[model samples]
Target: MTNSPKLAVRGLTKRFNDLEALSHIDTEIAAGEFISIVGPSGCGKTTFLRIVAGLEQASSGEIRLDGRPITKPGSDRGFVFQQDNLLPWRTILANAMIGPEIGGFGDKARVQATRQLLKLVGLEGFENYYPKQLSGGMRQRVNLARALAVDPEILLMDEPFSALDAQTREIMQTELMRIWEEGRKTVLFVTHQIDEAVYLSDRVFVFARRPGRLQEVIEINLPRPRSLAIKRTPEFVALVERIWNLIEYEVRQSVLEEMS
Candidate 1:
């Protein structure tokens, strides 16, 4: 019996000519885990996520799922981009339906699945709404629903809530936790907010800029079914402080490099 992470990335490196986006980065996300990748801007966190989603090819790396290599986009790995990226002309239901169509599920099954997903994401009555007609958070909810329609084993998200207001971001965080708890999907989320990372993650991976590498991996010791109220606890603050201190030096170095 082989015990392998659901997603394993080894010696991952990406270079754009003289620019190194990621380097010697290694990470393993187990099945059913919610892991957050956080770092300053330009740290290659999004690039790493794109590589795993097969949206972009890595310069060099080994990506594995259940111990098998991952070389292309597949339904098993679902992706939610920062922008909703909904079809400007399509209704919310139409947007959600497209997932199943591309994923190879037939119409009836796709329709049923999309409806259930719309409900799950709290957009039940907005099925007819278009992206132009929705708020940022609402659009992100549809973005999430579309990703879920295919029932992916692992979700790859890149700062899906960064655009919303403080209140909306908090609500979305709660919603995201609810989805993770109820749906039991493995997730690898990328974000720049340390608090957001600590609040929503099982483990938080902090990266360094300019040839990004994992600087630290902090395990969140907070209780499950985490609520907004958890943010006020002393334990949460202590963990956040510990994580912040670990990344502060790297972040300062990144800024200094840019200044020079």
Candidate 2:
């Protein structure tokens, strides 16, 4: 990895009227690194992600990509929502082409690229199908393909697999790791699942409860080309336990504060 950061967040904060969501967050993400953010609900995990994606504005602080301040949505960043959010009227291939279409690259090359992306997400022959025709897992794969069709430098994913059933979610996680390993795109994923965070990330950033602040950044030293079998190993279990402990403490504190 290069010493320079592909993405930089400095003193980032967000507020909604009287409610402060995020506070004074700072981090540097190196090129090709996969980072995941985890915290209790309403800890501004999604807020921080939206700020980075330029979908939402930060009340204070700055987020830069390659040192340029991000003011609004751009093709350089791709966002995948918790919901698939695919267009019902469009076929799978056409939906994947949305980004390239919006960017004015709706030519044969982009269409070809979109097809490749669909294939990459393991949806090669399903191009003619509509969003309603596919299962939840397949739709999410389309969502991922759409994001990658833009060929963005960074991918901002907010709980992309949280909606799936347990079996499908695990399958998608393995698929994601494979795709990420092949592409090595810099990714910032937000999830409430501690095990998911530990399993997929190079580093996991944990946040405190509302008025979210960075509480800890845990580095995962586990070997990569990681298989689902690794999740059963002592080392993987230990890492998951460690992260769960941090989050469990924050959850308890948040509950206590509410009770008080």
Name every residue pair that clashes in candidate 1.
none
Candidate 1, residues 1-260, lDDT tens digits: the string is 14578988889989988899898888788888899998877889888888888778888887888887777888888899888899999999999887788867857867987888889888889988889999999999999998888889989999999888999999999999998999889999998788899999889998877667787889997999898999989999998888888778777877888899
Candidate 2 lDDT tens digits, 98-141? 99999999999889988999999999999999999999999999
Q: Could you tell me which 10 consecutive residues in candidate 1 have the lowest summed lDDT?
A: 1-10
Off by over 4 Å in 2: 253-260
Per-candidate TM-score against the hidden true structure: 0.94, 0.96
TM-score for candidate 1: 0.94
lDDT of the structure predicted as candidate 2: 0.92
In terms of lDDT, the poorest run of 10 residues in model 2 is 1-10
lDDT of 2 at 122: 97
List ranges where model 1 is wrong by over 4 Å: 253-260
